[model samples]
Target: MTDISTTSRRNFMKLAATAGGGLVLAFSWTNTLASAVMEVLDDTNLASGKIDFNSYLSISPDDVITIFSPNPELGQNIKTSFPMIVAEELDADWTKVKVVQAPLDTNKFERQVTGGSGAVPHSWERLRKAGATARQMLLEAAAKRWKVSADTLTTENGVVVHKASGRKLTYGELATEASKVPVPTDVKLKDTKDFKLIGKAIRNVDNYEMITGKPLYGLDVYRDGMLYAVIQRPKAFGMKLKSVDAAAAKAIPGVVDVVTFKNNVAVVGTSTWQVNKARKALKIDYEAEAPLESSSDHDRIFKELLSSKEATVRRKDGDVEAAFKKAAKVVTAEYQCPFLSHSPMEPMNFFADVRPDGVELIGPIQTPERARADVAKLLNIAPEKVTLELTRLGGGFGRRLYGDYVLEAAELSSIVKKPIKLVWTREDDMTGGTYRPAVRYRFEAALDAKGNMIGYKLRGAGINSGNPTREDNFPSGAVENLLIDSIEHQSPITTGAWRAPITNFLAFAEQAFLDEVAQAAKKDPVQFRLELLDKAKNAPVGAIKYDIDRMKGVINLAAEKAGWGKKEGVSQGFSVYFSHRSYVAQVADVVMKEGKPAVDRIHAAVDCGIVVNLSGAYQQVRGGVIDGLGHAIYSNLTFKDGAAEQSNFNNYRLIRMKEVPEVDVYFVNNGIDPTGLGEPALPPTGGAVANAIYKATGKRLRNQPFINQPELKTV
Candidate 1:
């Protein structure tokens, strides 16, 4: 874990307060309302004192800018990409802006959580408006000095320029005057075509810091007089901690204290290595629950879900059953996807300093606001007393959302009555992770006599990693007649969100099955999709959640770029999906290498509205595609008796450099609002690759980790 003493929490807070000039500029009406809402929300405890936006930014007299990002950046380029949003709008010199993790104070900073690929898109408007407003005020100050109308002065490179008088002033020169100016209520924003820095390719702002080995990650945080903690959780789900003999652990060098919490015993020591060593030295005994003692028992739950009659209907279209009866042929296929782990390169770690006044938490957590509430509730303290500090994550992949490790660290600090750091070894991280729920989907499609698609029915059972009922506001009512049903297989093992929005894997299964139906009809997959899109666009079957035109645009782009219908030698497959308000379509080119399927290239087309930071957007699309390939081909979390079966990378494989395909990403040229890129590219990759594999071998591999299935092997 990071040494917080060297980078004292108090010192970091002080620097945050004075890092930016105290000039609150209002650039647009939307910003004015958002700023007011933020201030009101910050002052008033909402959602049980969650973290809010005010905690992140502070301007100083010197005009320096400091932004406290609450989201843990796990190698997703968030540290650079998110900051770019602020710099672009704030009109601050990208070079001069300093980024730091926000201290967790649920009462002061609400909603500091970052997940669901929302960091850039959600904050885009707010951060930009904040910057633009601030710039306008500074320009006003410069205009006053030059005896020129504010309209005559403009900002460039953090300087106010008066063209007529040739007068110039740095933001620093007008900091005091700008601070006193009335925050503008109506600020004009640049059009998409006029964007100077937003659409341009820029290197990560924190790239230098990372390359130089600066203390940017959660594991690098440290504190004075802090102890290190390690917890030993149950080896199997549903297993209870029977007993533990700490004599060996206590006798270990540098071991300070040993204590048992709710489910596990923690070993505390002077250093992380010491605590880890002591944890291993300690002899632990667990009473395994019978249901969790075997892998078959866990598999039984999935089997039960597959056959269970009690299923909640997620979406329903026209008479699917009647449509099936009227069809000339009905093709039915069942696809299965296994549970997965986020397994970010950086293991889970957090530092907590529990003092009488308040609790301080530092970690790579996705939701700082959630962390604040959890810590406060667990510690029986006021939410204001708990402060969460977000740090750079090695990688999130939807793993950091749990905040369980953060809670463990706070518990340790409270027990030890001193500052402490909790570090999870790779084994601890992998085993204790909140896994992506294993899911099974059954798809049936019917075609008319003319080989024209008629009706589609999909039924599936999976653990609703999110609110499966679609009752949650974000994904609530996203699709219609979709018939996404789920059963919560209650297990002691934790589960949470993954890369794409909920049901992404299911969508892949559904869309890929649609491709199969197209093949059964001997119709072009792209044309079949366009036909469905036309129906969904003009007379949508039900809810019509997606933007049909945007979806069609991406498919057309991918098909055109991949030389659809004309490409030869390599088998081609296509899939498209929408999530986080972004639309994406992908085509995979595959070839058999040594009797093994190898993806040679992927043609990806996306319409995320407007591109903010084109290079970063491209990187995210490419990264997400690679991520999808890794998950589909290599990643799986199996269980035996309720415990995760894979322990480390040695057993649980990941896609390597050699397997990475040449990715061609093209953005649809349309002046539209910006959406998220982090996850949109991931959902379609599985189906696209699956489609290509089918073309290569004339076989449909519906199961995930496709390499493991015997059916995937060619004759």
Candidate 2:
């Protein structure tokens, strides 16, 4: 039973005894948010009227260092990787360090978020100072005991050593005295050359516990008097609950209540199975005030919107129409993609204990502060009254970013007047739409008399998800007569942020179209991109948003590692993209297996600055690339009359283990601070696979979920 709280004071420290007779240290933070990186806390962060402190870390009498990890773990290895940053600076023996997961406490830790791959890049220097400050205090305590100058004492492997007198003391011997020393306002950090634990491979701290089923997920939370519940949402969009007949459901054993909200209904019982059964037994009716919508309807709307010339122009350089008129050749193409679901292994669930005075919400959430604020607004309660606890997620992938499920559970608890856990069944989760919006893009390019690429134009249309554009997109800031425009057609279905955000599908559309343009220019795809990137790197650009050198480095490295032109019996496809400050290039090799296009191998070159945990970075690249490949090749969602057509794994398929190709990942070496690798590797993988399929079978696929096409479906 471990819990942490925060307080602010001008230089004070307190040590208390835990239940196990171990020591717990609580201290004030002398430095403010201005001292840390500026990007950690957003403007909405409520850091007012408190002297914040480092509310983590405890030193036991036996020299066991317990450090609480600050960020939520979503299978990204932040639980193992973030603590390494601190342990490296503390000079502690890795074998003796113990890690604990910190709950959501904004007062204790600012910006306790795990999204946007910001855990390390935002908190690197701040956490280093935390460990370095504690080490300095321990050394000061040992120096006072020996009556020697503190400057003469050096620390190594959790011990403070005095070289002149040959006197040394373990951290345990100085813990009590160190608590009495004045907290230092400033501490010097160690150089990268001396780091011992950061770059090395370390096993996930929660690995053993997770494999042993030691109750790390929210589903494991239990209370003595809690009830189970299941929310029954509408089957389609623009649906309003007309009525619910719960007489049959309430007659079942263990059925406590059937609660009805403005838009949905929930069945409560003693167990999850009972509530789910009751929910299925209940008869409900809905009122529809709008026309029935389907995937075909969305497609028609997107096409109509694209045909309109009026649009919000995002970028325009030169006279695109004039360039196209004067060109020797002009080419045009269109790409379309369907809505996608995140499909995390864990279905949406939350445990909420709502009282008259406050609320306790526990779940696997990506953004705690946002959840707190949203819950407060819905319940008309104060923000501070809402307490959230973070749990190890089965998988996030941006599915947990919107905590609508959390709010639903809290509302159920409040209405039922009991602690309740709400779970969404697979069918309910599938039809309830928070999908990635479907989009369509129209592209046109022009080449000069010598077949030199000169101009570009793009028009994007989607259902409320307006458009996707990045400052460093291929040919961006490289072409003179370039123009990009987008229009939106609103839809009734719900949509939220997916992995890689808008850039996920945008990269596929842009990169695939560039390959076709290169073919028309009569040049190799890789060399054609290299020539444009050279232009973007040298002069003749508006504003460069990406490092051309880093981008080119990964592209060349991937081509070399993959042996692009040397591999025989396998057709290869190449693609590169930059996102979230990381550069990545991928090569995919394909072969016809049993008269179907099969991906044999994929090689990747990534430059995400410094690698925090070598093994974890490797895993991220592999997982992201495979996720993108699997989704682009076969994963898609369709709707009929505003309801999803697929329900579970039987209909909505994922990449199987047998289908995954051999993936090789490599990262460039550098001393720069580590950037995120969770997303950049995904954007290019889809395009690489698409281009490879084109080589294997001389057919151009302009739509996603390539397996749905007639010829490819035979496999």
TM-score of each: 0.90, 0.92
Best by lDDT: 2
Off by over 4 Å in 1: 1-63, 68-70, 89-91, 107-110, 293-295, 298-303, 463-484
The TM-score measured for candidate 2 stands at: 0.92
**lDDT tens digits, residue span 206-285, model 2:** 88888887777777777678899998888888777898999999999999999998688899999988888888888999
- State residue 537's C-alpha deviation in candidate 1, in Å: 2.2
Per-model C-alpha lDDT, please? 0.73, 0.79
lDDT of 1 by residue, 575-622 (tens): 988787788889999988887678999999999877777778888999
Show where candidate 2 strays beyond 4 Å.
Answer: 1-51, 163-166, 711-715
Shift in Å, residue 254, candidate 2: 0.6
Which candidate wins on TM-score?
A: 2
